[model samples]
Target: MLPRFLERLRQQADNLAGLLGNRVALFGIELQEESERLLGHLALLLGAAICTLFCLLSAVVAGLVLAARYGVLLEVCATLAVLFLLLALGLAWYLRRRLADAPEPFEATRQEFERDRLALNGARETAQ
Candidate 1:
């Protein structure tokens, strides 16, 4: 009986180790995926920002030149400046909202942990 108990104990330990290893691997995979996604988003945002900067500058210059021809360059500039500022503020708020609502990282891992906890608790209740 003692020998049988020892063997069962060893099997349980091995099973626990395997479960831990799998969880670790899952976590690593999720972390890597998250990092890759972040880097890709950053790269795209940077490119978009650069393109938008040049586009806005060119457009403003063109608009200003046209307004100068009509003797309303200063007024056009002031209006555009205010419009851009308001747009920037609105976008900033939207970005903050998006970030605040972003899903938790490692969501799968967290779910897995919860499932494991529940299963372990069930097992304990049954054993009792």
Candidate 2:
């Protein structure tokens, strides 16, 4: 009877493990999806910034050439500064998005640790 009871307990634990495994798998997929989304957003934003920067730089160079010939060096310098500011802002925005979308590995580990600790405590209490 004691062996049968232990077998039943094992079966129950296996079932619980299966259920937990399914939940973890689902959550892992969700995390992967979120990570992919965050990466995609970053890639798109970076690509756009690169293209815009190249276009702006080319335009600035052309402007500088014209300005040098026309004695408008001050305006050229101001325009270049604004372009740099815009690029800096774009980079900051991308960084913010990446940070916001980052996953916390600690949460998952904490939950698993708590479950194991509880199991260990219950076993000790029952044995005592």
Candidate 3:
């Protein structure tokens, strides 16, 4: 009877180990998924930014050419350039603030880990 009991206990331990391993693997997969999503979003944003920059440059050039016909090309171009720079700076600052305010990544995984720790502790105490 004691031998059978020991065998059952060992089997339970193995099952617990496997469960823990699976949970860790799940956490890793979730982390990877979130990282890939963030990277994809960054890439898309970069592409859009490049396209917007090209458009802005073309518009500025066209505006300058039109102003030349009106005899104030230099002044108009300078003012437009300064305005665009200030706008870009303002947007960059705002984006920085928004990113800083964003929640920590992998929050779900963190919560799951905490719950698992508490559960394991409770189990251990009960067993003792």
Candidate 4:
């Protein structure tokens, strides 16, 4: 009886270890995904800022004066500057919206753990 009990205990320990390993793996995957998402967001932000700065420099008085000396060139330059700036602004707004809408970190891991907890509790209650 003692030997059988020890064998069952070892099997249960192995099962628990496997379950923990799976959860840990899920956590690692989620963390990696979140980091990738953040990196993408940062790239978008950098792109927008660079676009804004480049366009803003062209919208300066010196640029306008130089374009103005060319008559039709002034209107074209002004329009393009405005368009680029608007595009940059739109990108920034999009990034902001995406950041705000991002899901909580470790969400899947938390959910899985919650399910595990509920199952364990249910089993305990039934056993009682």
| Best model per TM-score | 1
Off by over 4 Å in 1: 86-103
On the 0 to 100 scale, the lDDT of residue 7 in model 1 is 100
Native-vs-model 3 lDDT? 0.81
Weakest ten-residue segment in model 1 by summed lDDT: 90-99
Which pairs in model 4 have colliding backbones?
none
- In candidate 1 the C-alpha lDDT for residue 77 amounts to 95
lDDT of 1 by residue, 1-128 (tens): 99999999999899889888999999999999889867865776687668867877997999999999999988999998997787678757766776677667899999998998899899889989
For model 1, name the residue pairs that clash.
Answer: none
Candidate 2 residue runs with Cα over 4 Å from true position: 94-128
lDDT of 2 by residue, 12-110 (tens): 799778767865776687678767877887787789878887988798889999999999899888988897898789778877877787766346645
| Residue lDDT tens for model 3, 10-101 | 99899789877877887888889778867876886697689868988898988988898899988888888888898688768866776687
True-structure lDDT of candidate 2: 0.79
* Clashing residue pairs found in predicted model 3: none
For model 2, where is the 10-residue window of minimal lDDT? 104-113
Q: Kindly report which residue stretches of model 3 are placed more than 4 angstroms away from their true locations once superposed.
A: 1-9, 86-103
TM-score of each: 0.81, 0.65, 0.72, 0.73
Following a full C-alpha superposition, what root-mean-square deviation does model 4 have from the true structure? 4.6
Residue 37, candidate 1: Cα error in Å is 2.0
lDDT of 3 at 3: 100
